[model samples]
Target chain A: MPAITFIHPDGKSDRVETSDGESAMQAATRHGLDGILAECGGNAMCATCHVYVDASWLARLPAMADDEDALLDGAAAERQPASRLSCQIVITPDLDGLVLKMPERQV
Target chain B: MSVSGSPVTGGPSAIPHLDVDPFAMNFFADPYPTHEVLREAGPVVYLDKWNVYGVARYAEVHAVLNDPATFCSSRGVGLSDFKKEKPWRPPSLILEADPPAHTRTRAVLSKVLSPTVMKQVRDRFTAAAEERVDLLLEKRSFDAIADLAEAYPLSIFPDALGLKPEGREHLIPYASVVFNAFGPPNQLRQEAIERSAPHQAYVAEQCQRQNLAPGGFGACIHARVDEGEITATEAPLLVRSLLSAGLDTTVDGIGAAVYCLARFPDQWQRLRGDLSLARNAFEEAVRFESPVQTFFRTTTRDVELSGATIGEGEKVLMFLAAANRDPRRWDKPDSYDITRRTSGHVGFGSGIHMCVGQLVARLEGEVMLTALAKRVARIEITGEPKRRFNNTLRGLDSLPVTITPA
Candidate 1:
């Protein structure tokens, strides 16, 4: 299992191993990461699972879908180019050291 | 205004092209026609200028609700242009996220609200609902929404959550405004804002840790805070979600159930003959007249729905009411028959994001309706009922009924 680290918006961080085929949101949730709220169960509809992917890893991820882009626009935290809805970002073996940051709020 | 350029494009047939404002409709005292037009206008019709899609059909609405991935809720479940205007508050901890995150939060809540845990409080809840219904039946003529529906949930929910009822009057107004904001910024939002202004501070105060009781849901959230699951500050917001989402929805649901049974004497008689129908009656009422009319979900990509290309980032509104009465899915969709086996209805939503507190709502409905079915032999309208104006909720402001006690 690959390791994933989530740095809370408040600068707090927790690292957990990602199960094969689990998305970043799932790993955070299984480990009980403080700030990630995937309210819609990984459907890109609710922006509650908003996260800022490390800029270095941005190019490696797939392009944001139209729906993900629209919902990201509604995230409670300021939207950044690195901001991606965690539900849309599926975890694959190619990306190893994934570091994501939580948003100030999910609503 | 032509339907193409007007706000009421999918409005009732009588005024198809005109802008139909609910508040204005409230004055006329009936919006059933408007509901019909919206239902007839295809599954995803443009609500004129408001870039949101209106889903009035039964099948599609339930499909969208169940598939959170297709109709995502993360962009704040409300109608606010979440991209531009900041929400009055944060997204709901449980209702507004997709799975994995939604799964985690829901797990915590599901554990808390499990049937087993609810059983602990079931007797108390049943007793409270029964007592309120008993008291109301004694009066013979009462506003069903206010006296029974509103009274029962308001009294019991706050107690279960462990909050003091010193200034709980604001619960309905606050929740009404909160749910209204989910729709377009129309007259309904303006009114809710005005009505909620006075009670903002008290509501905020209730969210604080000091105000919560030790053994209730609110305090349970506080305990989660101590365990570092959620911040202490975020605890109140979680409590706020339960309080806001839980109250009026159930109240309206039960009220609608009673109203339907009263309107259809045969169903009422069937219920009277078989007291066991109380449970089915609640679900039947939800199917006949859904408490939640519509909710919006943003598509994750340029998804294809019913052969229509839902552009990425576009908002698609699911009309649960229309879906409940979808002619294709339900036989005699409009009729309120308690005996109908309505298993797959979207009244409590579908999928992982379905209502977490549904059991609580069901219990509330069952207790009240059972008491009424047992005590009343006949019920009829005493006067014209007043419908409450809300963007997302469908309920009466006042339901006047004359109960002929058995």
Candidate 2:
């Protein structure tokens, strides 16, 4: 299991251990975290699960798919270089200490 | 003929075309064959009847929904383009408006229906669902649609909205008209319009601030008006938007979930064993049986997609249901697999204009399905489920089922 840290926009941090292959969005949703909306149920479609990856960990994540990139552009919060749809980020053992900062709001 | 009289840009001249009216009764009754034809034809096919381009494949449909600026919904998300024709009613500020305007209004509504607010209703909704399921189990058998699906939402939603209880029956008919009017002015649309007139009036009357209960969503929108987020007049229309778009689609969704579980007993067993699969089961059900089948988006300008150039203002019908089951997207797209990852399905329209009320719908589904899973050992379809035909919705009028207790 990979432990993921979700830091809300308000600066509170909640860390949870997620199963391998479950999405970061799924981990947050399963634990009933408030910040990750997962509105389309972890679909890259809604972009509601927008999160800003910690700069150090960004290089280890998978490349943003074109559809995810496009949806990120329309997300409610400002799009930073580290921004990603959490749904697209599948949990894996190597990324055990992954950190994600929640957006101000996910519409 | 392009509505804007713009010449079609570079693309295949002799594009594959379909003559069948997608919204016609026969097609609505059983659209799978037509969906296959449209998908097999090409990425983009011309519809001769409506003179619009149709995309049934998952890739193209997904592209169109993501590129809202190119495939604009502000003109109206229906066959009748609002620019060229008058809308039957005031257009939805959230659904029919573009960015900037859409961004602001969506922000307001999003805040109103945020997860924080949604949490407020979950326990109450769950309790209500348990009560409904307990009463139904005593009967042993009932029409799942009328007795459970429709009954559950009608019992909870209107009261949650703080609506006066008397004429709540109007909600479904009014919603039918609202969704049907999204299609061409065909017999289905007309019939729904006629049947929904009084309900429509009632809905309009109830949207006023004076009519809403103090703590309801309607009243919340009215409070936003006082905070200067939106105008006083925009408040009621926003309330009207929720009323029109909310209930019926959910009823259809709940009905679809029950239909899918009853058809796939193994899936029901999975749900009964975990009970936590309630939400995922609902998502799978939406993907397997999309309640809202198709919606049209007009081209904002000459855009080339799938080797076809659609002119500005030309309507492009996106078959969301077809896209959900496109073989290109899923390994067994047509199968109702509860374990499948149904994340990308367009059962709820994608992008900015996606259903704002979806969280509410998901909650209702979770509560109802979990309640059934807890007590019902098996769901057996006792009679042929009758299809309810609408221009856009896919649902059952009646699904006769007998439940064996756990």
Tell me the spans in candidate 1 whose CA falls farther than 4 Å from its real position.
A1-107, B1-36
The residue-by-residue lDDT of candidate 2 on B280-337, one tens digit each, is 7998899999999998999999999977878898999999999998999878888998
Best by TM-score: 2
Distance from true location, Cα of A83 in model 1, Å: 43
Candidate 1 lDDT over A3-107, as tens digits, reads 878898779888888888888887877776757766445645446688999988889998987657766766667899999988777788877788898988763
Enumerate the candidates' DockQ scores in order.
Answer: 0.02, 0.13
How many angstroms is residue B77 displaced in model 1 relative to the true structure, after the best TM-score fit? 1.7
Q: Estimate every model's Cα lDDT from 0 to 1.
A: 0.74, 0.86
lDDT of 1 at A36: 74
RMSD of 1: 14.0
